[model samples]
Target: MVAMPEPSAPLSLRHRLAQNLRRLRLERQWSQEDLAERSGLHHNQISMIERARSSVGIDIVEKLMAALGVRASDLLD
Candidate 1:
């Protein structure tokens, strides 16, 4: 029988990005669906990204920046 490895802690970048995104969305009082519509992405995809289930690449980060009216640096914070 093979055993599965325990999940490691999330990377700081992932945690920072996810936290910043959530904070931004909440500041604007927008739902995941709202961000999805603005970014031309699926709601579930946004959910996944916010939850760090999906890796966020630069392209998606640019899209999110545009949708949220934030600079990429904002997410880094």
Candidate 2:
């Protein structure tokens, strides 16, 4: 079977979301480990989200927002 080629550019929303997550994490000087503990998510998952390597679900996003003291709109914007 032929493998699908990866896109040259990341999806706009995911890229923006990743940027916001990283900025928020850094603003508070919270490492991935801190976010993992606060969000009840795995450190790898937080890293994946910040790196735009994985799509996030509503529940996970909510957890992250709560941990970051941000709103969904703030993260999206």
Candidate 3:
């Protein structure tokens, strides 16, 4: 039987982005649902993004940046 490889640690960049995104949302006192409504995205999607479980798209990033009033670089940083 082929053994499955162990999972590696999550990327720091992704983790950092997740942390930053959550911080930004909390800074504005916005819930995932609130941010979802503002960004025209699903709350589940926002949850996935914040958890770094989903790959972020440019469009979603733009929407988040707009909704959160932050620059793309700021969030990614």
Candidate 4:
């Protein structure tokens, strides 16, 4: 049998951004629920964002950053 190449990681910007957001939030000692309330987004939405299962808009990103007292660049890191 022939071997297949390894699957690549997600290439979407949203997925990458989500990963950064999750890390920042955790570093700040905030739970998904806390981030959701502070960001004005739903808990599931934050969960989905962390899981890279959903897309996010710039506005939402800004809101989350503001609530977390983090810069947008931080979330993009």
Ranking by TM-score: 2, 1, 3, 4
True-structure RMSD, every candidate = 5.1, 4.6, 5.4, 5.5
Structure candidate 2, residue pairs in collision: none
Question: What 10-residue stretch in candidate 3 is worst by lDDT?
Answer: 1-10
Q: How well does each candidate superpose onto the true structure, as a TM-score? A: 0.82, 0.82, 0.82, 0.79
List where candidate 3 sits over 4 angstroms from the true fold.
1-11
Q: Write the per-residue lDDT of candidate 1 for residues 7-61, one digit (tens) a residue.
A: 5854467767877898999999999999999998899988877776678789999
Candidate 1 off by > 4 Å: 1-11
Between prediction 3 and prediction 4, the one with superior TM-score is 3
For this target, which candidate reaches the highest lDDT against the unseen true structure? 3
lDDT to native, each model? 0.84, 0.83, 0.84, 0.80
Tens digits of per-residue lDDT for model 4, 1-77 = 22223358544666567778888888989899999999899999999878777777889888988888988878876
- By summed lDDT, which 10 consecutive residues of candidate 2 come out lowest? 1-10
Q: Which stretches in model 2 have alpha-carbon errors above 4 Å?
A: 1-11
